[model samples]
Target: MIEIFTDGASSGNPGPGGYGVILKAGKYYKELAEGFRKTTNNRMELLAVIKGLEALKKPGNEVTIYSDSKYVVDAVEKKWVFGWLNKGFAGKKNSDLWLRFLQVYKLHQVKFVWVKGHAGHPENERCDQLAVKAGQDRQRHQIDTVFEQEANKL
Candidate 1:
């Protein structure tokens, strides 16, 4: 089983946003993060998980994800996402991300565990650092079209 810790940070709502992910399989580990010029916290949060799953090299892998975002954890763990999908995601934000997520989500055996941010968890702490660092490193980071694309629908 692979253990993944994920976090997303935004300097401001609709401001610079980024996600940090740390993956560990045995002694080998990898960290991934990137910043978007403008995005929301929830978007970054969900995106972090999506990107983390996308990074996996194989299907049928058992992966446990640690995340601080209730938006993500509850949607999956509490099964609200299925209900939302049944309703065609009406009145929902980030349907794009959610749809994108489901595509990759189905390929793995995945579970989500909620963790409190700023707590003492090791991988969570590292992900926080990486997220903040990437958010701060937005000098040359490209604008994420998803935010603009979705915002246009409103």
Candidate 2:
């Protein structure tokens, strides 16, 4: 079984943002994080989960994900994402990321647990710190092309 703790933070809405992910399996542990020059909190949150799942080396593992993002948790837990997938993600905000999520998601048995942000959960707090620091670290930032293109459309 594997446990994943994730968090995403933004310096401002649609501003500098990043995601932090902690993946643990038995005695092995890994931390993953990356920053984007422009993105929303929700996008970062979703990307955190995506990146974590993408890192899995093998399929069929039992994975438990802990996150504070209602946008990501509720959509998956409530079965809303399935409906969106069926309809080709019509009218969806982050269809690209959602599609990416479903691709990796199907490879494992996954569960999501929603936890309160800034609460004292050790791993969660660590993820939050990683996310915030990454967001503010200009040298580590990369362009979020999907977000940038969407913003151009508006």
Candidate 3:
């Protein structure tokens, strides 16, 4: 099984935000993270999972995602996102991220396990640290265009 741990951070609710993802597959491990100029915490949360799944090399691989976002995990497990889709994501906050998540979610046998934020899970703790660090990183933030565009429209 390919196991992943993910977390997201925002300086403020809609301030600069970022995500961290750690992937463990047997003896191989990788970490991914990036900062966004302007985005919500939930967007970072969902984007972390979407980007992690997109990083997979092959379809049909078993994937287990551990995340700190009930917003992300419950939406899938409780089938709320599908309902949102049927409603055209009406009154939704993160439709773009939801669609992006569904696109990658269907490519694999995926399972989501919700972990409490700031808990003692090693990978989850590390992801939180990484996400915090990412939010503070002052490097180029051009990768936030999609998020910025949406923020502008709001």
Candidate 4:
């Protein structure tokens, strides 16, 4: 089984954002993080999970993801994302990421466990630190083109 711990942070609602992810399986471990020039926290939250899953070298592994974002955990645990997909994702945000998520998601057996943020969970706290640090590093931040393009239309 693989365990993933994830966190996301943004300075503003749509400001610089970043996601942190830690993947652990047996005696192996890995950490991932990246910053976006402009993006929402929810995007980062979902992206963390996506990035984690994408890191798996082989499919069909059982994955348990720990996250603080209700927006992500609830949507999957409650089957909201399936409904959204069936309805063509109308009126839904982050459809791009969601679609990408579902693709990688189908390749694995996935579960989500929600944890309270800043509650001293070791892995969660470390991910938060990585996310916050990445978000603060303006120089290395990459453009979230999909998000920026969609935001421009609003």
List clash counts for every candidate, in order: 0, 0, 0, 0
* All candidates in order of lDDT, best leading: 4, 2, 1, 3
The parts of candidate 1 lying over 4 Å away from their true place are 152-154
Residues 1-154 of candidate 1: C-alpha lDDT, one tens digit per residue? 9988999999888888788999999997999999888888898899899999999989999999999999999999998998999999998888899999999999999999999998899889888888877887868566779787776777
lDDT of each: 0.90, 0.95, 0.89, 0.96
TM-score between candidate 2 and the true structure: 0.98
Candidate 2: stretches off by over 4 Å = none
lDDT of each residue in 1-154, candidate 3, tens digit only: 9998999999998888889999999999999988877777998899889989999999998999999899999999999999999999999988888998888899999999999988698999998888878888868553667767777887
Task: Note the residue pairs that clash in candidate 3.
Answer: none
lDDT assessment of candidate 4: 0.96
The model with the greatest TM-score is 4
Off by over 4 Å in 4: none
The 10 consecutive residues of candidate 3 with the worst lDDT sum are 138-147
Q: TM-score: which is higher, 3 or 4?
A: 4
Q: RMSD (Cα, Å) of candidate 1?
A: 1.2
Off by over 4 Å in 3: none
- Choose the strongest candidate by lDDT: 4
